[model samples]
Target chain A: MTDVDPIALAVFLFFFLLVTVLGFLAAKWRRGDTLDSLDEWGLGGRGFGTFIAWFLIGGDIYTAYTFIAVPALLYAGSVVGFFAVPYTIVLYPIIFIFLPRLWSVSHRHGYVTPADFIRGRFDSRPLALAVAVTGILATMPYIALQLVGIQVVLEVMGIGGAEDASWFVKDIPLFLAFAILAAYTYASGLRAPALIAFVKDTLIYLVIIVAVFYLPTQLGGWDSIFAAASDSFDAFNTENADAIAAGEVSGKGAIPPGAAHWAYASLALGSALALFMYPHSLTGVLATKNRSVIRRNAALLPAYSFLLGLLALLGFAAIAAGITVDNPQQAVPALFESQFPGWFAGIAFAAIAIGALVPAAIMSIAAANLWTRNVYKAFLKPDATPAQEAKQSKLMSLLVKFGALFFVLGLPLELAINLQLLGGVWILQTFPAIVFGLYTRWFHRHALFAGWAVGMIYGTWTAYNVPAVGDPDSHFGSPVATVPFLDIDIYIALTAFVFNVLVALAGTLLLNAMNVDGGGDLTSPDDYKADAGDVGVKDLPLDEMAPGEVAKGTP
Target chain B: MPDSTRGSRNTRPVWLLVALLLAVAIAVPLLVPLYDRATPTFLGFPFFYWFQFMLIPIASVLTYTAFKLSQAATRHDRAARGQKPPAGERGGVS
Candidate 1:
């Protein structure tokens, strides 16, 4: 809120440089034979153990966006924001059942991206391309949103985002931070984030642990915190009863009302189902050493979920502490600056900024792998060698980061957010092809493709038509929409998914009866059950079998 | 092939239990209407707030046990396929 605190600035810079050095140094840590293969660079040799994989995956899922937006929802009196807690609670149980299957198949076939799996499983180029393109498209706004996370923290620190300042000055600090991130990621690939995650998680846990335990006592206790939030919501509803009745204003509460119970549950469930489908989340899963690593982490990772719930409650604490901010995203940051001492606030700022950096690094690398393996290797240069493929991924990671930069700086922030809003629903459309295909090839390849297309078109169109509350003319206002036949509202993505399944089932039956070629299943049933030590399951040399080959590439 | 297929089917109940645990873990949280209330505050936190926080640990334990039970089934499946207990089981994951 004020000009940069000099002591805080020094503390933030010290940790920033510390991690900057760690990012470059990671290329040599647990040295791979060469850092020129996708396995080495894009996936950190596909060699992370349980401990490192936990931090890496944690970094990807529990992002800076969660810190900013989750609390902001409560601060802004949006009850559904609390859905994040249940979303994460449900997420691990779901992934435990499936991610190991993905890791096994990915390692078995050297399938570097989900699209690689799609192409190999379904043997359809167009379908693989759809999955690949959606991964990249959905990923870009996400990386941009990470930049927005850093931008928010920097603005809170008085570093950039001065409206009066020239454009360069307004963006220069963020530009510099991203430049450092881009260079390290290009140098070290997945290793950069994996190594730095240690530092990022340490800072994050320290700040959150201290903030949760310390902040509550400063403003009485959790009892008063919840009471204050409830009272505040009640007060607002009383004042805005007329506007609420007129449908111009939303009534606020600590818990979702009965009418919104479906909305609350659907958003949580839909997001949980959609999350691992994102390329970045899958990248972390595939990067681990073996199947057990994933399952154990599923059990362990909920520790973060517990802390995340407390972090969400910080919104209520901010209310009780009598802090106010115009942009709700700044509420937690503002609360930190007001309550904590100078150096500690600096550490908190660094935590959020580094939180942004780790995920951004991982996302760009994942999207880059998708482009190199699925788009470049699969189509542009089918016989490209491992070295050439890695070269392409290295260069593509840089370009993907630049595209994200453009999203943050070039276009309006709303465009990136709206696209990200669509990104969630858009990415879910690929779920049937990737997830359903893992368990059963019962869904026909072309049928799944048609399902994907229908889902994507329907989700985008429905989301586009959902006007904002009070601003009936605006588009993409809410992610929830009224179900077609039901009076209740739920996430549009889930509804689209229902339609997608019906179409896929119908399409499969019709296609089969007409004797359409269903494409060969390159993977055997045992492939899903393959583990690290199994034959044909390590990182396959590219010439032996580059992923997405229609014919059997297995020697 | 029939023997191996039957081998997997013979162990179906343990796999079924894992499935049941996971199903409960996933479905119980989505039944939000059951806990959507302000009555019966626990240590000053509302029933709604404290109850959801409590589900975190319950769900974690359920998943943990599911992982343990499934590991045994996975080992049996691997043995049926004439594979070792997955270098993962020989020692913990590297």
Candidate 2:
């Protein structure tokens, strides 16, 4: 590694400070008369129309993960990393089909988290609790993953953990970043992220466009880079493809056919399904003014996906440039520094660092909403006012930030990576019950519960058995490790989804045969199409049902 | 249900058409990979690598079609409710 450059680091740090100031000032920029309700704090008063929702959801979905990890995966795994490109492309149609209906229903009912909808949909406290806990659990690691992105950028810029430095000196960046993130998020709530998304997306686009054109020329050409990568792949296949085919790694260059193709498709589908389920993605959708905004954004957001395809190719550019990042995740940042002038490299670093801020803000806000609507009111304070709920959410947002900081600082990178894999397995189990529930309520409430249980069991068991090269301890290897028989990567989530469908169908049959009556729909068919109607308490009173009133079944 | 309609034929066809186009939009990606070989080159990148890039433009065309179709449906729905189209009919659908 080269000696640290203080000047470039200072410029990057200054840009981050500018963003923090902007974040704090956003409270006044979008100020409402009162910021005491969850609507104001969590969803930005639901005032965002098409323009802001486009940038907000774009910034949220195309994360530092897009800028950093996807390319790192490409550098490490060849064709497999390209899956992110297609997964994002396919995600639009999947979301377009169902997400607008979800937005219409949630906005009509004044719901904040998906869990709140579940509580009203199933009229079952236990199931809503499951959704809430899963959301919180799934979101924490993702928030931490953003910190990992920031960590890589800092390390490349010579600002993070030193080799011989004391623990405090080494870990100060993680603590300091979380401190700033938590403070602004607590102060401005969702408005902080929504406003900053404008800056984040502009910088990211600028950096990626420059890198795609600039680096290819410096590295001889796109032709040279591709030729080098292809030659490298060919040599590896000639020498070790047989060994790789026989389940042995004779050389480090070639990817086995099964390993390459399965990893590509698994990561693609797994990420697509998991993408919308994240609290941050939901926060972006919920903040929009109407259902059409959500649909139109989904239709247009592939512009960012095209950017991702460019970013992934930078991996091959890094290979051609002969750049070596100490951590593979720093591949993109290091590519910028080696190929560009110091000032532009500083700008690129700022893009990644600020990219972390938008998603981090949205994630903490979504988690806080979960705590407010589900745990705090459901158990702690059933009579809580809007003002009190907002207060609790602001505080809880800070706690979630610190909780994620601990994951980034305390654990090894490998273990932290495993937690994300575990998060995926657990999160994907929510799809059948949550995403599918948007379309049809045919799956009975009890049957939904049974489906969840079956899926969770199968997903976890298969994930626990996946093994990686030289590390059996790394169970459920990220999108690449597959279980036997199916010989597919342990997107245990998809496997779980299949199991969920089977059990749900069978359970429905058995319940009907036993003369068990399905609970009535909590929402009329027309409610799914309503955006504003009979708006009452934000938290629908759980105990207000008169006898024989239809208990909220899956609606 | 539509036999008693008074004016021109029902406009529900526009919505059904949009929904069918959405299904087709979704189906194209499912079909592309079946024929894509790993090593074949498209636009200097492998077929597997570049097919998704190609799909983006195709999807945008489909989205524009849906936008137009939904606009017509919304106008029909509004007319059925005995409401005039707003001063700005620029925004086709809700």
Candidate 3:
């Protein structure tokens, strides 16, 4: 790496080291009675108030990749990139509708993971296992995308690699970053991200506020910015006219036409449905102190969505400023580096890096919680103690981070993005089992499992067959596909989800009609209403009820 | 598990109104073609961009209103059941 700016690099490292120290010390910041329980390590003792939960969940949802990639997509594609805006706007209401119930039931049962709730709701170990496994699978690529975000920043800073640098040399900075992250996450579970999120989010907000207000002035005004962006897109369309005419690449414009409307809508809707189902998102929700915290935050968290809208405008600003990068993912960072002073650029870079760290820590913790509770404790050793579970979760968190590190370092970045796209498709399959299961037990566990299998297989196959423009022979290239009997292209995830629900409904009916024994429900309907400070329920013993007996007559 | 408080007061209206608000918040943006245009601009933002940004606060206020209504319903339920409302429920937006 040549001509690296020492001032910017030093400033970036200063904030990085500061957050690393805070991450390690956070283990003791809110020390619980004991660190031996999954409750303490995995969910921050299940005691985060509304304020902390707001920052933590906000930090988790709006990641470095989002800060970078959303604007990048806007810079590259135009209107379709704005799908993120509507999706995030709609997400809170969806979360408002269902998440409190999840928090209540999970709190009542002392559930550490979504799978635990599934197991309790459906009385099926396999269905819970499916939820847990899908969570991990979907999360790994997402974590890798975070690393890709970090890599973009590092590459922009000229610290990571050169054209012919060896892989080890190229990835040394990434490995170092991951090493520090894994160390703190191992020492302090969800607490690290919970604490670090404060710093990360503050930096993000400051950077965006400054960038949104300041950057536009530097490159004329908003009108010129939009005009420049429009010009660049027009130029790109002209350059790629053949591909556009052949329907290989999407047409470029600030607004999409009638034909592309379904693709945009389905993407926004499908992503909104899938966002909260991510294990890390739920982990943040479940960690809150009460049902009101969930409700209040659902109301309050749209502040980030507003901030995200401002951030997305930076894409047009980047085009107006004439910023260019080999990878469009680097557009935002490259814009900051080009426009801002050295120290401010350093702060912006630190914001992006810490952005990666917060979500990475939370995601690994969530994935670790899933693996420990569902796979290790459920299938491997049913009698594992809370202490044992805590220890296993700590270790598994490291493995999960390293696995994401390997994914970014070992594979092409395009593949990482593709895998995360597939992840979005895959995670939506669990909605029928988890989100639907929250409201009803009418869905047979075996049928839900079968539905999950069908959705997973069908979604993967359809995604694999869709060819990417310009990158011939690549599979899983786009999330949109034509409906089976109709000539319309829509999000494959929503289509597969429909198939999942229909199959699940049919199977539930047939199974019930055949007198198949639907497994016993472990949670009472009242458990869905229990909130923090509720008497008796919070202290319910893990095995207070027998395997199939619901808690009856409890008031 | 049948509690007297939940059954004593009617909360269906509050919940139905909240559901209606949320439905509108979610539906307006998903019907993409309606706002996918450039003519109507706010501070140089095209309709596609500004329309979604405007929905953020509208969604938030609707959610907050729903939260307050639900809280009010809970308080009403407690009073109807001849029980003292929890200390935390005594004051706030309501």
Candidate 4:
């Protein structure tokens, strides 16, 4: 702990405290009629305009883990890590086509979560329950990954876990950070992240712009950086040739020819499809005021992707700067500490720590929303009022945050990473129910459920069977697997998603032929086009009833 | 209802254009082997690195154009129906 730089620690603490105060103050920043409703607490009163929604969703999607890990992946692997850039680029256009429809319909019916939309669209509580449970489960590992991001920054700063310190003393910093985050999030719900997002994005853009332009010059410029990176990788590949020949280690440097190409493409496509399905991403989209905000932000949000490209280059710059750490995850922070002054490194570290705060807050809120709306209210207490729902969500938000904390502390970081990878694989299974159901009701409810189950089972089984190149005993070692019978390696998530869609299609036809009723559709095609201020839309219960009064809100 | 009908009809061409742009966006990046190389460097960055970076703004511009075209089509439909455009629609550009 004494190895931590005073200036950096001080600056980090300063920004952390500032955001904590902002988080508490956020409860009143955008005051609604009352705090006794899910709309106010869970979705920030559902009135965020384009600018705020841009910051919120941007801050949510481009998370702290991404800031740390994408570059870390580049540091560890080569061009394969660049998969993130394309995955993010393609995501906006794909979401551009569907998310506006989601926003319109969700807004029309005051739907609070994607599961809410699923329930309404499919008219099946059981199907919606599956989507909700998957969302909560997938989001837990993501929230834990954000904590890992903070821990990496702390470890680089030398205040993380000491080699010989007791576990309690070593993890005090992580616990402290999580405590403030949990307190503020419990106090303000989605508003905490919504307000803090502005600060997080500002710090991130400032740090990235400075690092992108300044770091390259400090090293021997971009050409030297690229040369140094290439030289290192070339040496590495040559050194590992015997191991590569024996398939003891994976090949290095960019996506190699042949099957690696399929791996890269499928990972990109599968991730793009899965990105918005995460409950946290939908939480951001649901917070916007109108349909056009979603569209407008889709256009503007690519600015972050451009920034991310610049950030990914920092990995090469780290290699060129001759900064080395035991963990590739520490590469960026190590680069900043070695190259920049202590004060600037502190600012960069604060940008990342605060970065973790924004998403962790949103993810917990999202998970809590799922629990309150889908699990608790749907199962335990169908008669729960809005006030009761908000109360349960706030409590569950705290529980979810701490659950992620326990996850980071209890599991090996490798296993945590594996779980997060599995999160992506799991969340994509819900796409057929949520995304496809937005456009049509052709898929039978039972068929969608069966598809989700099959996708989950196949994805997990195949992912579990994949062994690390050097360690055959290590299961779930990679997101890519053989495409089964095709004998080409592709992203396991995409393969499972293909199976998901097929089973759904076949089952729908079979179920329809058997004359199984596909349940009722509550939303009309016009509902998908209903924007804010549209006439005769379903009125939000909050607007119709007095605050704190129990109203029978439409499911 | 008639406004929405007109809105969909007028935006059909714009949607088709958007679909084409999106197709190109997905295809160029998925065809990884085409630009997955060390040569053809720009500003000292490899072709693999620079080509993907270049796609960011292209995607952004295409998306923005589609958004504007769709909005304009919707506004035209609303005007034809003698309804004023939504208030939030006007101030977004600035």
Candidate 5:
């Protein structure tokens, strides 16, 4: 009934400015002695401890995507939206098993990206190129999705004065926010994100905990609140009974009923597998000081998962508050403004804005690592120095930020969302090589190539055939699509993954049994369990020398 | 299979621990679906939601446990091999 308060807008801008200042200053907080190598620029000197790793990786993994989209999906769909929660839960155990091995291998080989490991492990440059290309491609849209989250929060706060502003004007807030991100990342590298993570996560917790308890009390008790939501869901379902029965839309205008369970499970699995494969997640893992830091962080990170559970519940709270907006993505932010005072709304907005920044910085840095190691050094300048590489990576990080900004502004909102879904499908193709390669060195290079190709093709086609709701003009161009026969909305990437694995197995056995050359192994079995003695860790204690090392290498 | 052989004595505990940890992690999600409805609520949220949420912390404890056990087991294996145990990479120290 009333316009969003200008005072609320001003306070929101003030908090956002504070976060940006913090983001810039972060460049100095963990300033490495030199920013020459990818280790310094790309990984913040690989010096993060367990608590910092938890927050950095947590801030990376739990982003504005989790804040805006997951709840948006719940507000729009229903039960299907809960996939994010389970996916994260499934992710920890999976990482618990695989990540230590990844750390050991990465540490052993001095590898920067998963592609680097792939290249070293199989001695295949072409495959490493594919992994690098895929990492960059998948990361760009994901960074854009973070902008979408910021856009939703900014729009909810009515930051821009225009009531019916042009599309560009509506997104100016996002552009300015990302510009700040680009600058800090270019100057500080991964440390910007790692340092800002402390603030971002703390703010997110404050906002969500307050909103979860405050909104319910303001509207009604939790029971009455949920009852109202259930009523709304029931009423909507009754009207759209045929659609509900047909599995098109659930009564809640949120998750449809027919394919909810399947969609939930598929999203959970697809997201879990895809999570670590992302360059940002890998960057976080690599930035840790040692295998134990990673292990300790893995144990401690469930606390963030606890925070995620609280964040997801904001959707039901929004529903209970009868919150509605032109864009469904604004459901949670809008709910906060509607229920809370001007000061608190400003704080909630800060959380979302800062939340977007942390991931964007990490993602940009990770993408830059791909460019420097996989693209630039691989092709442009093989003889490049660490300083030159760092300089080149800094420039490339800015370019990646702008690329994401364009995607956020130029594409339609739905298209941006779809592109990310497509990105998931695309990144999942790397799982077999990245995660599976850590434990067993058995998968042949030819078999992996066959698997990767099959997955990419099938996932793309399955996604292509999926038409948008009630859009005849749209066909292959859509990003997120329903499966051909199953008719469920999922990251088409997993479908491709399943097919790729099958083909790889088939291709490997068929080729191997026929005495086809499976190719050479770059690493032997002993390499898997090799310690610093093999890698030549200097300054070891004198008493514990291995068979071949100098006296200083003794433990 | 010799009772006195070093290979047989050393590798057993590492395998046993890996299997146990894997079983617990894999079992909770698979088994919880069976008794999810039977479990009662903690607060307003259901047992299903709580159990899934609980997995995060539980999994963390399991990982730290697994890591410690793996180190100990690896040391035993190295001792049997008549080599000094490898230095556990101190990952958390910046």
Candidate 6:
């Protein structure tokens, strides 16, 4: 293979070093602030305003998952792939509805993680542990997905490794990048990602805007781009008509055909419901200055969806530009390389790599927060000091990253993607406990725990049975499956969610009949309405909590 | 125990309207059959493509409107509870 281009490598390394320096310096972003507690390290002192909160959340949402995963769908001609656009549009409104209550209650109770919120709200340590373990397990593959995004960009630049390079050598760049990220996140906590988000997002928006408006012009125009994509799909379908008839492959299309209508809609609805259920997404909300900041961001963040909608279409732009690659994930990066100059293309590559880092940092931190708050404090050391808790979170963040690195280095990428699909399903199983607890305490903790367990098993089993197309023996092939009796294809997560709610409802009714004592509610109604200046709504870290403070604050 | 009875005490019609606005914004885009067409093209864009892009602004305006309504409703709720109005409503940091 040819050596990597000197000019592009220089430019990419320049921005990479710049972001590394910025990440290390972010330990001091807030002057005189000490990284001594979960509140400061895990949630960035819980003081980010509307602007910084917007970038941080945007950094999480507009991630490699957005830039790479979404476009690769359209490039590969998956009809249901465009479901991502509607998925995001539906997400903000859901956020506008439920997230404020979560923020308010979390502020009132010194909760550093969602599991902490569950422990306080439901007072069931076992149920909270269930939630915490699910969050950590689900997030590990998500972080690996981000590493895949960066690896794709590096491969396009020819810096990752040559075609036949050894696996360890092929992944050295990712290892170096993750090492720096782990170090800075340990030092500054959430603040490192929160600060670097400002740079990463700006570069990303510039690259997308330039590529969206400029690429179509270079490849004829939007009309021809659409036409070219449609024509390409038609030719592919004709060539593979025999395989399509045998169900060995899915048909290529620009939009959902009649049968896929439910698949598209259910995917949108299901992902919208699952998005906020992710611990990393909530880490952004809890870090905001107050409840209003979350609402304001919910409204303002749709601007990124508009940008994302445009970016997803770059897959079609690749078609019209005649950019072809065996792996569809390589199309967009290869587009930037062939279409843009060496220098600007290097800048774009750097942006994508850095973009992946933001969510990777946030996801590991969220997972670590769960381990420290729910598993460690709840079970091992009931009276662990705040300093000790922060130390635990920092170390756990490293361990979590190493676990994700195992997924990247030790396993195949497709297996990781399939597990990430299940991750979405498993995380959504916590919705009954979390979102319901935000509104009412009616659902018994035991009932919710049972629902989570049932949903997780059913979802995993169903997802495991869906055979891969073109190879009828493999499983975890798709996220959608046919409904049992209704016989329409829909997202497996939504179906599992329906089962979860029904089981929780029936179990709660039975428990209420028996008068089985729900441990106790540690929160009051006012806790859901409290804000920054409200009584007992102090923004103190858990380590700062004095003895009997939780007991005293309950009323 | 005292706060448990006040679930609806601070509730306002604006809050109801906020929920309505957000619900519509969320549900309208998920109704795939409504705009899943390629016949009508705008600026060389299919109806399916442009319509979803258009929903972005339509949803934004609705959500922005909901943001303001919630801000006002929250102020009224705080005032009713004998507390100061929430900060950061007028671009002020908390």
TM-score of chain B, per candidate? 0.84, 0.70, 0.71, 0.68, 0.66, 0.82
Shift in Å, residue A317, candidate 5: 0.5
* Better structure of 1 and 6 per lDDT: 1
Model 3, span B42-85: residue lDDT tens: 88877777887888898899888877766666556556655555
Clashes of each: 0, 1, 0, 0, 10, 2
Q: Write the per-residue lDDT of candidate 1 for residues B1-94, one digit (tens) a residue.
A: 1222445445678889999999999998889898999889997788888888988999999999998888878777777767888657776532
Question: How does model 1 score by TM-score?
Answer: 0.88
DockQ for candidate 6: 0.63
TM-scores, all candidates, are: 0.88, 0.84, 0.89, 0.88, 0.84, 0.89
TM for candidate 4 is 0.88
What DockQ class does candidate 1 belong to? medium
In terms of docking quality, model 4 is medium
Q: Score the docking of each candidate (DockQ).
A: 0.69, 0.31, 0.59, 0.55, 0.35, 0.63
Estimate, for each residue in A422-536, the C-alpha lDDT of model 3 and write its tens digit: 6688899999988888898889988999999999898989988887765667666677899899888888988999999989999999998999989899898878766666644
- Candidate 2 vs candidate 6: the DockQ winner is 6
Give candidate 2's error at residue A184 in angstroms: 4.2
Scoring model 4 with DockQ, what do you get?
Answer: 0.55
Q: List the residue pairs that clash in candidate 2.
A: A121-A553
lDDT string, candidate 6, A144-191, tens digits: 777777777777887666657896787766776677567655665555
What are the lDDT figures for the candidates, one per model? 0.76, 0.64, 0.73, 0.73, 0.64, 0.76
- Pairs in steric clash, model 3: none
**Residues A1-555 of candidate 4: C-alpha lDDT, one tens digit per residue:** 338899988988888778777766764755653543435433432455546544544454455556677777777654467777888788878888888788778877878678888889999988899999998887776777777777778888887667678888778767866776776566655545544556766787678778989889999888998888778888888999999889987666744556577877777788888878887666556555567766777777787787677787787888889877666778888898889888899999998887776667667776887798789988899999989988888888888777778766754443234446667888999999999988988899999999999999999899888886688876777778888789788888888889999999999999999999888988888778766777654544332111110111100
Q: After superposition, how far is residue A413 of candidate 4 from its true place, in Å?
A: 3.7
User: What's the residue-level lDDT of A125 in candidate 3?
Assistant: 86
Q: For residues A1-555, write the lDDT of model 1, one tens digit per residue.
A: 469999888888888778767766765754664533434333422455556545544544456657776787788788686888888889989999988898899888988678889989999999999999988877776777777777777778877756677878877766876776686566655555545656777888788889889889998998999999989989999999999999887788889889889988988888888887777666546666678877877787787787788888898888888777766767788889889998999899888887777677767777887788789988999999889988888888888888877756644342223334456787888999999999999889899989989998999799879876687877777788999989999889899988888899999999999999999989998899889888888854432111110000000
> Model 4: runs farther than 4 Å from truth?
A25-62, A162-180, A187-190, A385-391, A402-419, A538-555, B1-14, B72-94
